[model samples]
Target: MSKVDVQLADVSISPVQYQAQLLAALQMRDLDKFTQLLDHCRVDAFSSVLESACREADCAQFVQQLLQHGADPNILNPVLLQTPLHITAELGCYETLQVLLCDDKINVDALDWLGNTALHYAAQNKDQDTVLALLEHGSYIGSRNHAGDMPVSDIEPETLEKFLNTRLKMPNDESLLFKYDFLVPPVALDSALLKNKLSDEKDNVIKKLSSPSPEMDPIVQISLSSKQQHLLLHPIISSFVHLKWQHVQKFYYYNLAFYVFFVLLVTFIILHHHITAIDEHRKSCWLNLSAVCFFKIIMITLLAICCFCLIFKLLFQVCISPVQYLHKWSTYPQLVLTLLTINVLFIDSGTGDSAVTVITLFLAWTRLLLLTGEHPAISICFHMFQKISCTFLKHLAWYSLLIIAFSLSFYALFHDSKAYIAEKNVSSKLFHNPLISFFTTVSMFVGGFETKFLPFETASGTSHIIFIMFMFFLTLVLLNMFTGLAVSHVQNVQSKSELVRLTAEVNAVFDIEKLVLGNPVCIHMWMRRLNLSHNAVIVGIFKSFVYLWLSFSWLQCFRNIHHSVLLFPDSSFDYANIVYPFGNSVNVTWNYRLDHKVLLQAANIVQKKNDEARQQLDCWAVFESYEERLNNIEASQLRCEALQQEILQLLRLR
Candidate 1:
């Protein structure tokens, strides 16, 4: 009989006597006999000797002895198509896995029949050491199995967050919040691997299993998830982003400089025009009228160019993260600013025109902050402000009904407070109209009790009671609620400041990538000869600028530049051609031991993340089985009821 037929503890009487002895030694967990048997035994594809050794926690020493003699650590069982490490991982044999990992020749990331790495099994296991060992050994965290499930996708973030790092000063990497594709350019979309479609029957099965809610659809989830940004705390990813940041800095800075110049010129023109229109003496004065017109023309031209650039950049940004770009509150304001600027040429000099110019100017200043978001500090502050604003607005939506009720009450009750208005001489139209009264109510909440109601005449005691209740509600309840909400957001921001800063760094880098490179073309960007690619790079840069003016959007004429430069060593491009600013020559990841150590640590972190997703899927399978069994029992019950009804009908006929 073949060695595969041998039972775990039941060793049969066979001619290959060494196989029986080896099985006996492994079952007993004997180190001495196992070592002696290894000298006579050899590594074979069909042999389950090494696979059985990894099943026992105490057999690590024997497993190491087998590897030292002649047995392969990476021997795959023909049936399961999994290596010994896969067995160790699935069984949570921490000691056995530790022994296997020590072998320099071991394939730590060996794939099984399902295209799953040993780390994928490790993630599903509760053994922390096994997962950590695989990660530190450099099992790629971003690797997706044949089912399109990433290792990290199995582990829920809430569970992973519990044990990740509670006490130590080790920072939490929030960048893992997003999928790998967020930073990855569209180059992978062109890859043939993603183009394959599942069979129609398989699609139908997925649809039946999936929730009927459209929001839960995979495409909808992907779009929604795109809005969630990340804090790129990983050193390898951050190193790449820092390089990209340098490439795009010049274009961003140039835009800022031109904007600053234009804003100053607009301020000068607005002030000069105001002074001239009002002052009789200056209206007829020809002192620098020609110069004023010259600057006005320059301002308009500069503003027009700025508008075009922003629109073009926005278009490219949407292509990278479509949902994210559209949902941003800043997007609407930017669009409005561009439209107002276009109308400026035809607008007449009057109050209507002044209002439009002022709105446009206000929007222009806000964008200044958006432009400066490339800096880490600025990006953190901006994100903090944005998050807090969202939180505050959520509360405001709930409180708006109360504010509206009070405003309408005041407008109705105080409509003809004739004696009070005449006595106070409050000429500001404070509460006479709907718009004015609504704002007055809001201001009262913000600035404390408005003393203007001291002498207000009321039709009855009911009006006085309403006024008192409104003051109490605004002052005591909603004000404190809003204050507490803001405070909580501020405290949270302070706690995750480092992670948020890293997130901003990632966004800044991506913005630059979209602005400069646009997208990858069919041809490889790596230049063997400097002259060939250099000309292509120059032409790409020139075309990017023209795409803005030609169509007020990013419409590339030539081929796209290489995105591989932004991705660096992780990308498909050869690593030897790259040179980075590694200050003081500490250690190189690929060329030295430092990167090897880092890869292992990164792998360990990712292994823990993938732990729960597979477990959840297993539970879903169990639920489906129970439902099927219920359906079978229900069909049997209906048949029995029909037979009883037929028997009753026969008795009635007799």
Candidate 2:
């Protein structure tokens, strides 16, 4: 049963007395005293409901009692001029709001100082029920707040349309209709549509959007300003990037598999041919290949095949973007290592070419880290390594001055002192060169401690003070300071690691795109390759033979990939039928006076949905042109009529 909100019999009571009684009843939840005061001015029903609401499910009217008593529900908070209902909806006080909305006298459309109505707050907070309730009670749909944002601007249009129409009765206000009158411009006399409009708009948009240009990408540039470049990690955009990476990463894996097997073969060759050298200087050496056996020749042939595959991969990548490939850290390392491995094929010299191969082998294994760094989970550590190493290198130049200064001073102080330089001592050897002292100082900074490899027998008191000071400054202060800064930086980077991973993902994706859809050169190359093989009988047969040879079980991952397919050829995606799914159920009446949002496409998603929406986007341009043509024809007709009327008037006068 519905309980009375308030029933104050005494009309003789002052507004101050009623306001004081109302605040007390709401705060204390004492319905007996409140009802005693309200009937004689009492609040007993209000207190019982407020207190019992927790234990009982069917408690009638807590705040609903206060509303019945003419306790103003529209009371503004003074700061924002927001009423109780505005706060309730904004803070998501659903239970109290139900009670408040039951009393119709509560002003649902009350505006704050920012001119935001209760509906604006409800929509912003994403309170669907409050938004519907306010809309049902006639909240203005087209009302722009002081920020020039309507309620729809904050809330999703899909959600509002889904809930509002099915639930609430349509309001009578013109603003509630939300129909926009899209104005088309009047016609120019010239035939602009034939050629002029091509240069004007469409061509420029295609140019800006066709390539991997940074001009259109918004959040992708979010990390550009940051110290460590990171991509904006939105759910939709990140997923798109991940899918894009999947399309292109198989080539890298193919090349990586070949390189990995090649390194393993190099390992086997090193072990089989290695020997302890009789030379005093060299401890170990590779045995010369004087007796080449059948198994050895097969291993060599396998190595040659791996080398051929890798060289082809390198050439393919380099030709796609020569300048980028040459300069890239990823490409140049692989190239240098491959060249070193090739050197062993020519030179049979003992220990030299095998030594080169050993270095390449070390790099080949280490390079696995770089290859795997493209992955999102692992990229963070590599990014952190890069950022931290960069921090060290940039600061190392400055710190080198201190090491040099200390080294030179130490050398100058005791270089020629007969007492300090013992015949068999390391100091005698080290003090002979300032360069040795500088290098030793640097080594000591990392590995060892103290200035002495030996005790100073007869150094000055000034030298002793200097030695203590150098140790204190370099080891204690400087080292700890570097540690603190690095620790702090690590902590800072930890917070932004997710963003770093996303940017690395974007970087990895675009690296693949640079060979396919993104670069002008790559796209041209794609089209060129397609044209060469494009339905040509001989070329198709050659490609078929090549693919047949490559159709090994191991190459399954790369079998689906081909150059012609990389161009992302147009498919039967029906763009012409692209239409808004909701037909008449939605009504979003827009005032023409509001400020328009400037941006268009999300550049990261870039034209993937162009098949779905491209024609519809271009339709507005054609419609405008058609409208202008009609206007021009109508205007000419009016002028011709006026001329004929003038001629008739002249004939009548004669």
Candidate 3:
């Protein structure tokens, strides 16, 4: 009827013209010319061919042939500019897509003329199998068409099941829909696009899946458990109290300032009122005593607060890092309560009759010791011995000054006189008068003894008048010197006492386990090692003895206690034996010299041992196995022995 359509050389006849010709070939399953004509025909000319294929219901094979021949499934018609794949999918021809996607050349990701991919059209057709076919080929699942419908989301459960059945026939693709089982809703799809760049990787899929479920992490689980434990151990109100201690230092200073002002003002008022009714001498002493006591309390309270704050902060910082169940005992609430109770129980009354007051004072001193982080025994002894040479020189200077002064005063008393009797009388006054002797002795003890060398008296006049004036002037100077020394001594004592207290506290907090994790802090562990806790007092008595020795020698000039015993930067000369001159001199007459030699020999042995130990440590760092370790040790020991033998041979030759 079509003028007897000619048969080609391949023995396949052109069955029908135009759309019908293409459809007949597709129905007959003649893939050869079907592929060729698909290549020759323009997309515009192929529109009716697709429609005819759909009508024949042999569209699946036709679609596959078109794609194999390089037909763009995404290409629009010349008139409508729409793709055949979208049109077929919209018509619910699910088989067509399965065949189309199998070709692997068609862009499953491509949109149609209506801006709808095959997936979009499939949702409109309510055909889940077609949707999945496009999805498996890396389709933009959940993407909107021109009509704004998300076909992926619109896919019904039954339709999805059907699609999944067909999907089993296809190779697994790393698409968002393949990775996540749930259909990505339209709202979520947009949000996910903004936040995360979806990668086609398994690890990325796992990470994304876990992002919304943090409880799956073991560390997070541990943290949650620890939080519950913390809650069980610490009451809510107590935790609030603990947090307050975080800023205790600020509050401590504020309270200290206010307390000092209040206490001093009250003490001053009381003293002023009492002084008017009491004798001058008694009034002055009482006023001084009251002021000292009041000030001491304020200082101690502030020091206690500081120590508590530091300890609590340290405990919390470490505990929080490991997500530990923070104990109530370690918390600020308990620490503050304990500290307050100690203060109340030990603090003495204003009249100094209360045991509570004494205890509180002692605790305050302890707090100050911790705050200073200095060791009383070690620092005190060190400073005392450290100053021996300087102290001795100072004393020597005073002694020379005193001798010159005594000689000059004698000369002035008798130089122009007819008799030595008048001179003897003046000189006797220098030694006999309590005021003169006191001033002169004090000056001689200090380097200030030089002023006594001045000649204030003469043989011509009565020496008593000149002697009195000299003594008066000397008294003023000596009094000022005593006041300065006393004040400095008090400050030094306070500092040392505080150090001792801190050392004790340090000892309390020193745990071998904690030390292994980190060094002991806040507490002076080094100082504590050198201290002795006995009865109610932990005395660095050795430090005191050393101080007494240095005070009497030429070494009192150097005053820093803590760093005193440390080796001097240069260390060219030995200063340890130089401090206690009198003691060393006396000891040298006995077996002390032998003891000193033995000590030196022991120190040398220790140094040699330390060097060996360091060598071993270095070797261990490099060598891994036990056999290697043993070899290294043997080699090092042999070398050391050979070196020692060589040194011995040299010494013998010398």
Candidate 1 backbone collisions, by pair? 135-600, 135-603, 135-604, 136-600, 154-612, 154-613, 155-610, 155-611, 155-612
lDDT score for candidate 1 against the true structure: 0.56
- Candidate 1 all-Cα RMSD: 20.3
Candidate 3 lDDT, 1-654, residue by residue in tens: 121132232334332344465666777878776766665554444545654464445557666565554455555556544566666677776677566566655555455434466677776666666766666565654445444444545555455444333321112121101121112111111222112222344243323222111101111111134222121111111111222222122334453454344334333433433444445644365357677546655654654565455455456445322223244233344344345433442442133344444444444444433323323234444343334445455655765564455445644564443322343354324433434554554564454755444344443354555555445544555446545655666566456553333232222222211222122111111112222234223333533432342344342233232121121212112221111112222232112222233223333434554577789987886665777888999999999999999999999999
Clash count, one per candidate? 9, 19, 26
Highest lDDT scorer: 1
Q: Give the whole-model CA lDDT for all candidates, comma-separated.
A: 0.56, 0.53, 0.42
Among all windows of 10 consecutive residues in model 1, the one with the lowest summed lDDT is 522-531
For 530-573, candidate 1 gives per-residue lDDT tens digits of 21234766655643433333343243332223332243313322
Cα lDDT, model 3, residue 548? 42
Candidate 2 lDDT (Cα, 0 to 1): 0.53
Q: Give candidate 3 misplaced runs (Cα > 4 Å).
A: 1-51, 158-654
